[model samples]
Structure formats: structure tokens, C-alpha cells
Target: MPMKVRGAPQAVVAILAFAGIVVALMQTMMIPLIPQLPRLLHATPSDATWAITATLLTGAVATPVVGRLGDMYGKRRMLLIGLALLVLGSFIGALSGTLAPMVVGRSLQGLAMGVIPLGISVMRDVLPADRLGSATALMSASLGVGGALGLPAAALVAERADWHLLFWTAAGFGVLAMALVLAVVPESQVRGGGRFDVVGAAGLSAGLSCLLLAVSKGVDWGGQVTAGLLGTSAILLGLWGWWELRTGEPLVDLRTSARRQVLLTNLASAVFGFGMFAMTMVLPQLLQLPRSTGYGLGTTMLGVGLTLAPSGLVMMAMSPVSARISRARGPKVTLMAGALVVAAGYGLGVLMMSALWQLVFVSSVIGAGIGLAYGAMPALIMSAVPIGETAAANSLNTLMRAIGTSISSAVAGVILANLTNAAGLPTLDGFRLVMAIGGGASLVAIAIAAFLPAHRVPAGTLPGREPSARRAVRISARPRPAERAGLPGEDE
Candidate 1:
């Protein structure tokens, strides 16, 4: 029999949300070390960048694979394994003085990126019906919070202490998160029991590695190398799609993904992801550029991070608001509202970059949009897919967003590199151009969101919600007065 573990719903939600934030925090924790990596590790500037590139590549490959494993084996088991990897990676990083070990450690850290999606999936299986929406909203927005908060925290650590302390602190946090999961979060009884698709897994990994590596390194690698990698990626991905369709149990269910609601949401996610990265990439550089540049703010790294930190808080604060909107108007409308706001934020950013306060205001507006949009995506996806497929579906959606960010990074890099001033710094015009493109990307997402179903059962109501609640009623042999009055039933 599947083990059905139970616990206090609120504690479970908090533990999972904390785990999600910790995992997301790993993504940007190393940014402050990038310039110093060459001198510290005795490597060329290009080679030192692998420390960041390794994480991005590994994260792209691991997210979907781990999600499938969680669905087949157990989500809590997979989540624990991810946290264990995070701890091990941090320990390795803490000891590393060379680029090689640092890259290896960062790769392992990336593998744990699956934890956020798995945490959201667990909420669906465990939380009470009414608690599920807000819980998942908070979980989804945790990524933005971790990333925004990590910048200042990491900058402070890099400035004051031995850089290795960053890894040690990360290790300590991972250990704490793991212990909380073991103590509080329950193993989900739901499972998509099937033979592991080894061939599908390998095909997808190889394809994504080639695709993402090409996109990420294209600006640095020049045209022929980028073209060759793109060709290889396209061929491998095409074959993988063919293989998945023929397999008994595929790694990703392409047919389910092709559904109008799911298809549009994923499409919007990619564009929204593209829109999201523009601010993260643009704001810090603009804030830290030399004061000699006509528009540069000349702030220190710590100041840049602090200035942007409120955006993360704004995201967190918007989570419940997103849930409430999803509950009232449907996730489709919530998503549209979010994309529209993000577009407006970028439009404002283009006109407001002369002052730090303007940048903060723009970042916070963009953050709120991202929070609403991110909170709505899982709801749209879960509502359209089978209950057992939750983790895998959410993971794929996460992967799509990662792909969008990778593309955004490449596009922004090319623009900045080519649009430099006499001092070799990015010109104000280049920053404005990137902001315009970001707004355009959000506009595209809004257009896609418009095509989604006008109303699917209210967002965040899982496919299994009513059935599971009814089962709870039967097992308890006493329905709550709210259940007896059919409030949960009204969601359907």
C-alpha cells in the first residue's frame, strides 16, 4: 500500500516553501565572485565562467529528469535526495580553490533545482483544499524571492569574509531544510508508477545541453560553433519527440502538453521568463557602472543588491493577491494581468533609469507582475493535467522558463556587447533597448494568455481536489460543516 503520511498542513507548507527558497538561492549566490574567479582560481576569464555556465546547463538538464523520477518513485524521496546533493555540493565548494571543483560543485547545486517544482507538487497532494492555492502561490514565488535576496546577502559575504563562507552557509541552510522535510513534510501517496524511460531521459538531456549551451555561449563562441550546436540540438530534440511518442511511458507527455490551455501557458511562461531576466541583468549593471557614464548610478555591489531586494519582498506580498485573483477571475485573467503589468514596468524603466529610486520602483513593479504570473502558471498547468502527472508537468513548465531566461541572457549580452560606448561600457541607449525588448516579450506573453480558456475551474484547484476531500470525509466518518454545506464542491 502507498504510505499516506499526514501532518499539520501549515507546517508542511512553510517547510516546503523554505526548501524552495533555499534551492533557488543557489542560482545567483556566486555572481559576486565572477570578476575575482580568474585571479583566485588561476584560470582564463572564459574558463572561470564555466562556474556559472555549469550551473545553468545542469539545472536545465536535471529539472525535467528529477520531476519524472519524483512522479515514478516518490516526491519526498526525490526532494530529500536533491537536498542531500545540495549539501554535498556546498561542502565541495567550501573546499575548492580551483575552477574545476567549483564547476563540479555548482553543477550538483543546479541538479537540486528540481526541488521547487517538487515542493509545489507535494502541496497539491497534501494541503487542504482551501489552503492549496495560497500555499502553491507562495511556493512558486519563492524562486524570485531567493534570487533577489541572495544578491545582497552574497555581496555582503564576499565583501567581509572569506568567500568560502558562502558555501558553508549554503551547506548549513541545506542541512536545516533537509531536516525540516524529514520532520514535517509527508511522502505523497500519489505515484505514476512506470518503468523508467532511460532512452528518453538520455535523449532529452543531450538535446537540452546542446541547445542551452549553444544559446548561452553563442555570443562568446561566434557563428559557426553556435550554428553547429543548434543544428545538433534540433536534430536530437526532433528524434526525442519521435521516441517519446512511440514509448509506452514517455518522459514528457507531449499530447497533454499540446492541449490549448497547457500549450498556451507554457508558451506564455517562456516569454514571461524572457521578460523576467531582463530586469535582473539590466538593473545591477546599470547601478554599478562608473559615474562617468552619463547615466550610470555608480553604486557598489551591495547597494545594487539592496536597491533590488524590495522587488523580492513585493513578489512575496503579491502571492496571496495572485491567489485571490486566480480564485475570482480564473488563472488566465491573472496571467494576462501580470504580463500586462510587466510590460508596463519595462516601459516605465526605459524612461526612468537616471535615478536609483526610479530603478527600484521599476524593479518592484516588474517583481509584482512576475509574482502574479508565476503563481498562476502552476494552477493553469495542474488544472489541465492528470493528478499523477503534476510534478513532471510543473517541471517542464519550469524548464520552459529556464530556456526563456537563457535566450534572454544571450540576446541581452549581444546587445550590450555591440552597443558599447568609447569607454567600452554599455551605453544608456543599449540599456533602453534591452528594456524595450523586455516589454515586447511581456506583450507577447499577454497575447498568448489571451488565447487560454476564458475560465477553467478556478485556478489552483487540482484535478483531484474534490475527490481527495471527499475521501477525507469518508475516512474521518464525519464531514466538516463546510464540507456538508458543499463549499469544496462549488469549486468544481
Candidate 2:
């Protein structure tokens, strides 16, 4: 019989789940503050966007590195480091009364975004096999739940008290998360006996930063700067790819990543990320526009946050349902279904933009789709790779999603800029166009997922096998000729 571990598993789950929630909360706590930027910092709308963009850009660059490092060193160690960064960043932001300092703080907070994947990895390490499915689902839902819950609360705090208090609160949460991780999380046994790829890291970071900067600022920066930055990014990224292929120990294993299933899944993930963020980027603007525009809902920040907040609840409710569907049918099927749901939701938005409840309904539908899709992605990647490659592959998947969101933001901004209605005001038409484009991208993701092969392994297979004399005998006595030739009843 297997040796039973001590400690209440439920308590372990709660600690990790809360830690994941705190990490995700850091991502969207600034949403409510967008409107107050002009008054608080005396800055332009474009300048204020930097506060959000800075976090995104920094997170995009740091996620893959942190993920790889977590696998190499230890997930628990990295989780603690990430939480420390979150607390430090919040403290910095709390001390700030200016735009530049706040932006710096947001960048530091981005470092903590790595905690989500690290937390997920910890679940794989600690949870019993039967319990892992539900635990993983809840942990994934924490990303959406934290964002949704954080928004309304952050808005309430910002509205009633000082905006700086929001960061202070986040700092307190970060400290709590650190303590929980130290207390409950186990150290990883996995170790990478290779040097860190410094060259690849630097090259990839520079390339991605340039690409994201061009995308985020293209609306204001005009053609020349955009073209220059994009060109430089392309060249640097190409060089990085080549270097990764040649290096024995790469930051990301380009060859392994280039596998059909891995590549397509990641490509689909990018599109999914793009589509999901489009709703987030556009909804607040639509809600807050002046009533005179005839299309605006003219809602307050708190009201808008509440209205959109139910979508997170929807995601939380769907998490276990998605996991079950993936287990029963397969992850690719679940992913395709999610893409279709998202596309359908976007289609609904295009038809019913005038009604407030319609927007709420559509947002919830999209949130459900996202929850389903997000839960399936890591499972799909983990299924396809060796145990040693888990973190690197998952990190690449996360990075691809970030890249997609950056591109989507740029495209949506351009659409809104060009398609405004009369009276020099942005119209619902621009928003419609953006959603339509996002819907089309979801279709592409569905098609990609359709072609993904299904390979289901029985329990107690390769990674789960115990190191015992019976296991060795069982392995040695396996039918060799049939297995080698890929005949019927062969070992997959």
C-alpha cells in the first residue's frame, strides 16, 4: 500500500488557492483607477494607460523566465520570491503620489504574476491524484475570481478612501500569501542541472519589450516609431529563436516547442487571450462614456465594476464543470467547445450592444468560455511533454497568451480610432467591430484545436510508476516486438 501523507488536504488546498487569488488580484486592481488618473496625476488618458500597460509588459517578459526558474530551482522558493515582489511593489506604490513612481510600482507588481503558475505547479506536487482535478480547476478559477472580486472592492475603497490605500491593502495580502506559502507548500524535488540561458533571456526580453511598446503606443506614436520598434523586435526575436535552437540549455527549448500539438495549442492560446482581453479593454469605456453620446450607459465606476463583476462568479461556477468535461471527453474537445462559446458570446454582443443586461449576459458567457479554455490548456501541455519539460512548456503557453493580448489591444485601439461615429465621439460601431474581430479569432482557435490528436494514458503509467522490483519485472516482461513495432496492444 502507498504511504499516506499527513496534514489536512483541504487546508493545503485553501492556502494555495488563496495565494493564487492574491496573485491574480494584483493584475486587475488598477482597473477602477483608470478614470481617476487625470485628476490624481494631472496626466493624459494615453499616459494613464501606461500604469496598466507597464504591469502587462513586465509580466509578459518575466513569466517565462520565472516559470522556467521555478521548475529548475523550486516552485515553492519562486512562489515566495514572487510574493515578496508583490509586497515590495505595493509598498512602493503606497509611497507614491506621482504617475512615474506609480508606474514603477506597477512594473514591480508584475513580477508577482508568476505566482499563479507556481501555485498550479505546487498543486501537482502536493495533491493526491483523485483530488488534483478539482484543485486545479479552483486554482485556475482564482485568476478570474480574484480579478472580478478585486475590482468592486478596490473601486469601493478608491471611491470612499484614498487610492493609495488600495496598494497598501494589496501589500498586506501579499505578505499573508508569503506566510501561507512558507507554512504549507513543500519544496520541489525536481532540479535542472544546466546553466541559465542569459543570452536568450536578454534577447527575448528586449524583443518582447519593443514589440509590446510599439503595440501599446502605436495609436499615439504614429507610423515611424511604430515601424522602427516593430522592425527591431522582429529582428531580435528571429535572432533569439535561432540562438535557442542552437543552445544545449535554452531559456525555452525551441525545438521541443515547435512540435505540432504544442505550437498549435499555444497559437490558439494567444488568440484566446486576445479575444478575452478585448472584452475587458472595451467594456469599461463603453460603460463610462457620457450619456449624451446616445450609446453610452453612463454608469459610475463602482456600478460598472459591479455589473461586470458577476462574470467572475460565472467563471468560478464553471471551473469544476470544465475539468470534468476535459476528463470525460478530452482537453482538445473542451478547448474547442470553449472557443465556440466565446465566439457565440461575441456574436451576441454584436447584436445587443444597446441593452445593459445584454452586456452582462454576454460577458458572463465569455467568462465561462475563458474559464473552460484556460483550465484545459495547461493539462494539454502537460500531457504532451516529459515531466522535466512541464514548466518550460507551460510558461511558453502563458507567454504566447500575453503576446496575443498585446496584439489584440493594438488592433482594437486602431479599430476604435478609425471607426468612430459623428460628433467626434467614439461610437458603439467601433466596439462592435472589435468584438466581431475577436469572434473571428476564436473560430481560428477552434479549427486549430480540432486537429489536435488525442492520446490518453492509463493510470500508473510512465511518470506515476513506483521504483520497485515488481515494477522493473513488469516493465522488462512487456511484449517487446509488438511494442517496438507500434502494433495493437502496444505500449503508447
What are the C-alpha RMSDs, in order, of all predicted structures? 5.2, 4.8
lDDT of 1 by residue, 211-246 (tens): 998998887788999999999999999999999888
**Candidate 1, which ten residues in sequence have the lowest lDDT sum?**
470-479
TM-score of each: 0.94, 0.90
Cα lDDT of candidate 2 equals 0.76
Q: Which portions of model 2 show Cα errors greater than 4 Å?
A: 1-7, 42-46, 456-492
Candidate 2, residues 119-145, lDDT tens digits: the string is 766666555655555566677668778
Candidate 1's TM-score reads: 0.94
Shift of residue 175 alpha carbon in model 1, Å: 0.4
Model 2 lowest lDDT segment of ten: 469-478
Against the hidden true structure, what lDDT does model 1 obtain?
A: 0.86
Instruction: List the global CA lDDT of all models.
Output: 0.86, 0.76
